[model samples]
Target: MSKTVTVSDQTGTEALAAQLAAVAKPGDVILMHGTLGMGKSAFCRAFIRAVANNPHEEVPSPTFTLVQIYELDRLPVWHFDLYRLSDPEEIHELDIEDAFADAVSLIEWPDRLEYLTPENRLDIHIEPGSNPDGRVFILEPSGDDWIKRIDQLSRDQA
Candidate 1:
């Protein structure tokens, strides 16, 4: 099952990200799905900032860098962008296994992960909504950890 959330603007996206960040813990993996300009980076920026409890922190996209690691007070955050990756095997160089075991990971262009994708994860598909700034999030949570949180979030949104 999936839950859909509609956000009117960037602020709405940030608010949603904040909610997730508050509940996120080590070993949590969030797989982001969307096309170019769909605000995946924007959502991640907000999520990392909220998790770090810093509103002014610089959250840059890992597009060229491939991955960005942030050592926050709680735990590390590994943000991965696999758009430029030509092969999934290249992920080995990023030491993603460590992030999988100990940190909270947010991935963009996760399709590149292929067989390496974790079994327990929350997959969020972003699509354009009614307005220019609006976005519709279709959340598919696979693990118990995510199902419970997403269920609560559904009720909260209701």
Candidate 2:
């Protein structure tokens, strides 16, 4: 299933991230796809902060570092940026298989991974909206489980 959410400002974007974080847990994978400046990093930062329960935590983009690991009270999170990767095989060096085993993974530019990504995952596509500071998020679930979770998210927000 799929759903779209419009975020008007940075705060709204963060709120959306926190809401998503509430339903996410270890062993979950969230793939984010968007062009540069589409707020993918911002959404990730907010989600990481929420999961860590530290609103002031310093969450940096993994563009250069490749992957950033955060140990939240609930579960560990592995945030990955594959934009700089020249080959998908490079992911093996990072031991991503281990992280995906029992961690919440937020991946940006996941196209590089292609079919390597698990069958069941949440794919979030971000795009520019009509408002100057607005962002439109298109969420596509990979399985029935995610569809139910998305519905719960909507009900929670309501």
Candidate 3:
């Protein structure tokens, strides 16, 4: 199942992330796609905040750093930014397989990675609308688990 959400601002994006965080579990992979300045990092920040139950926790974009690992209530959240990566081989050097094996991963610019295979992933596409604050978020499920989860999430929201 798939779902689409329209967010008007950063707060709405955060609220959506928080809602997802409540249902997200270990071993889940989230693939985010959007142009620059589309609030992908902002959504990630909110997701981590909700998962960690720490709204004040600083979740910065791992642009230059590549990946950032956060321990939230004993669950490891791995956030990856591949915007600066020019080669897919560079991702292999980062040993992302290990991170995927141990924690939940939120990957930005996943299109840059060639070695990774998404098993159970929630694919998010964010598009800018006519209004500056308006955004169109399209959620696509990549596996059976996500299909069910997304369906449930949508139904619950309804």
Candidate 4:
């Protein structure tokens, strides 16, 4: 299933992330796609903060680092930025298979790892709108569980 949300500001984005955090489970894979300055990193920051239950926690983009692992409320959250990757095979060296087995993975610039990403992942496309600070979030669920969750989220927000 698919749904779209309009986030007016960073606060709204954080709120949305918090809501998602409340329901997200281990083994969840979120693939985020967007251009530079499209708030992809901002959303990741909010998500990690909410999951960790520590708003003060630092959530930096792992563009150069490839992946950053965060211990959130004792649960592992793996944030991966594949923007700098030259090939998806390079991900093998990061031991991502084991990470995927246990943690919730959030990937930025997931297109670079399309072949490696799971088939049941959640795909999110963030787009810049006509107005500054406005963003259009397109969410597509790749599996039955996420599809149901997306539908529920849509109804709850509506």
Number of the top-ranking candidate, with TM-score as the measure: 1
**Model 1 lDDT per residue over 1-158, tens place:** 78989888888889889888988999999999999999999999999999889999999889999999999997789999999998999999999999999999999999999999999999999999889999998889998989998887742221
Is 1 or 2 the stronger prediction by lDDT?
1
lDDT score for candidate 4 against the true structure: 0.83
Quick one: RMSD of model 4? Answer: 1.8
Computed on alpha carbons, the lDDT of every model, listed in order, comes to 0.91, 0.87, 0.83, 0.83
Model 3 vs. true fold: TM:
0.91
Number of the candidate with higher lDDT, 1 or 4 = 1
The numbered model that scores best in lDDT is: 1
- TM-score-wise, the better of 1 and 4 is 1
* C-alpha positional error of residue 54 in candidate 2 after TM-score superposition, expressed in Å: 1.1
Per-residue lDDT tens digits for candidate 4, residues 41-146, read 8998899999889899988889889999997775789998888988888999887887778988988888888578798888989988556877788889999998
Candidate 3 whole-model C-alpha lDDT, 0 to 1: 0.83
Please tell me which model should have the higher TM-score, number 2 or number 3. Answer: 2
Worst 10 residues of 4 by lDDT: 149-158
Better of 2 and 4 by TM-score: 2
Assess the local accuracy of residue 73 in candidate 3 as a C-alpha lDDT between 0 and 100: 85
Displacement of residue 148 (Cα, Å) in model 2 is 0.9
Clashes of each: 0, 0, 0, 0
lDDT of 2: 0.87
